[model samples]
Target: MSFKKRGPFVSLQLMSRWKNLVGLNVSIGGFVGKYPHCFEIFTHPFRRNLCCKITQKLKEVIVEEENVIRECEIDAVKRVKKLLLMSKNRVLRVHALRLIRKELGLPEDFRDSVLAKYSLDFKLVDLETLELVDDDDDDDDESLGVAKVEEWREVEYREKWLSEFEMNYAFPINLPTGFKIEKGFREELKNWQRVAYVKPYERKDMSRGVERFEKRVVAIIHELLSLTVEKMVEVERLAHFRKDLGIEVNVREVLLKHPWIFYVSTKGSTQTVFLREAYSKGCLIDPNPVYNVRRKMLELVLLKNRHSKELSRTGDETHEEKSDVVISSHDDWEGERDGDWVLPILMKSD
Candidate 1:
């Protein structure tokens, strides 16, 4: 939550305004208090108001995470280049790129650091759009036109010795746990997998049939998920790229229809789509630096409850010790009360 704040500390009053944004049922102070390990509550000396800030440990973790991302700038550039190559026009909207910037491991200032720095590879047409520059005149069309999935398809064909009809158009699918295989399900799945469609990076004529068009949309989504760090993204976030990616149908419905290739999780407030093959037991099969840093952040957040419990127990012990000392002092006074009466009377009389 502090990561989203613009300043070092956020006032309780200001944080209250973000209650709806953060989906908090209680006051911001109450929510922040729960996460003692992650956040520190303090009073501003000048303002004399309650404020919240991230703990020193959490701040260091955030800085370390940023440094890790900075170190991976080369890979981030490559991801952006591949994205441009995957687009229909070899151009993508700046807004769409911003939506998935973190997922793609690009820096916060990617506009200047990435697009402007690599001027020979990327042409900034305007403030809102960028295009890929053709660096080599001798480069053939086929070399620039391949989609990432084509490699997987080729391997499937060569290693499995599957027929061209089965391997060329098929996508790898991994069903989720407890997915019952109904009668004729395998036959139906096989038929759908064999249906041919235009690859995501390939050009298609307007006269293509509905089946082919929908299948191409599936390919586009698969490629997009593969590009992400987690191989998962919110369904709503993906909707922002619909126009730029040439997806016309309902994205949610499309994901639901192909459950084998994708998994729609409604576990939280947002519906997230995950590439089935990229994950095992709810974890990414191959984690990247950015993903590892994010997992560290999660661990820090989860430690808050345990930290709070420890503090509570220490406070209770301190209170008990004080009570025991007071009780002992009271007992000593009672025992000496009968003998001390003479000294008190003498002092009063004098």
Candidate 2:
């Protein structure tokens, strides 16, 4: 779960590698039996413990969502557009983007989908950097397709206020119900709430400036949240890539520092931070195609649970512990017989 990037499934055997994994008390086979939809237990053919793989249905759902992401590349490019425009050089490092690309719901080949199609709006420089450029070459270029970002923001602007005072609307904050506050917390909250606000896409020169560091932090975090479908994430998950997001080591303090722009939910044991502007009445108002596909995947997982429950009544177990298997001295799943299949194929070809 810690090392693997976003994938179709996670291997439960990783607990063996870490050894100190807490809270997981069940055997691998029993765990798969519990969530038949999300996981499938497979014999490694050599390794003693069973290996967990994603079901075929999960793979199909993943592939379908990949197509959906491809169709929604324009939305992704707009996100990239806003992100690059937020940066000082109108460019961002590709490797850093790689870390959060899936979270942003960008196609694996976003360069081909966004930059290649609209050559003037975006440019890939020296293969490692993505830069935002003017599309002055073709004034009528619309091949990149229309994105929901523009229309959605326009609607928000109109609905929130009349033409004159539209900018003054307060972004709502939602804290978890059980959160506790210390003495004088209200006075501190008021002091932190007064930071100057900057629109994400607009450029500001904060260098050699006072009180600008927190404002820039807000802008970067706001834009990062905007890129996510949920407009929120596990506090620890976001903390893992603070440097990649260009925030300071202790920058998560900024969330506690500014209560107006962020909301911390302590519903779970750990905290979940949310962009207060992104939600209304505890529900997200954004229309994200990526988010829709994720919901579809959840629905399929639920359906798989139902199907598994019915099938299990036939006395066919989902996973069974193999008592006779030996724990090999090898570290990886494969042992001395790893390359044995290649030799037979080579001999047959001769």
Candidate 3:
């Protein structure tokens, strides 16, 4: 993914290292041959083998990618800022943030670019925590500030419905279709959903209704998942943050209780909990800016694939006119031979 890691070119002799991973099925020369417009093979700088270099067109594509990241930076900032504001003390541990910083679209030196740049909005205290500044007088940057308490409520026009205790965030549950539900389970969830408890942003009050405790558990998990790039995270990874997030021992049971908001996929060896709202038909529905940038990264193609498409569109004439390559026969290639002897760095004893 680093544009300059290979120094704008790679040796054909080393293509095998990347072929399978990059989905290539041709020899390095054939690969470069297929995309003569996008890639060229030249003698290696110091070695006898040849290397493939990206054409000017590919450089232009990389430039466009940089522009997209710049355009999406503001949206990404608000996303990460909202996550910090949602924490219990409006602060989260530095280590915890680092774990998901890539998923949060933070650059490696976020302390300077993101945290320092948003100094009025965020601060790294004691080099150990990221805390949100509590000033809320300005509406201009509210998106980067603690969201209004009322906004946490899942439903609007709450004054007309339910009591003061039920005035808490309405944790809506929309189960996947055809999911069987027993009457007792439905009844318990109905009470639990209506039960009011501490939101992820508020101070915890242990003294609460029986159902309120369960609601808080769900809220904690909800906020945690919301912080992810895909609004989903590995169940195993989530377990590590249990103590930090103030989760109880019955985390697994709590996750099962809300199949609507959270969907656990056993696709991998471990379970991954996905926020249903962020996905549709197994694909991310509204991908975050971080993920969008990754998607753009994926759009990049090896020179071979790009060249093949160009030839198909313009015919062999274009390639004949453009390429001056004279590929050598495989037998002439100086690869490892049966009689070749290995050299030892240390001298043999007499």
* Model 3, runs deviating above 4 Å: 1-66, 136-169, 207-211, 227-229, 236-244, 248-253, 269-271, 283-293, 296-350
lDDT of 1: 0.70
Give lDDT for model 3: 0.57
lDDT string for model 1 (172-282, tens) is 888867999999999988988887887876666532788878888898899888888878877888888787678878999999999989988876356788888887776
lDDT of 2 by residue, 288-329 (tens): 777766765666545544656443221222532222223333
Give the range where candidate 2 is weakest over 10 consecutive residues by summed lDDT.
341-350
RMSD of 3: 11.5
Better candidate by lDDT, 2 or 3: 3
Clashes of each: 0, 0, 1
Query: TM-scores across all candidates?
Result: 0.80, 0.64, 0.60
Best by lDDT: 1
Ranking by lDDT: 1, 3, 2
Question: lDDT score, residue 13, model 3?
Answer: 50
Query: All models: lDDT?
Result: 0.70, 0.54, 0.57
Error of 2 at 34 (Å): 3.3
> lDDT per residue, candidate 3, 1-350, as tens digits?
33334344544555545556544555545655555545544554334455565545555554554565456666557766676665656776777666555555555566667777888877888787878777768675454433333454524455456554655556646778898887798787666666667766565565376576777777777776766666766676677556556675567777876788888776524567877766667557766555654444344432335435443322112332233344332222343332122110010010
Clashing pairs in 3: 35-307
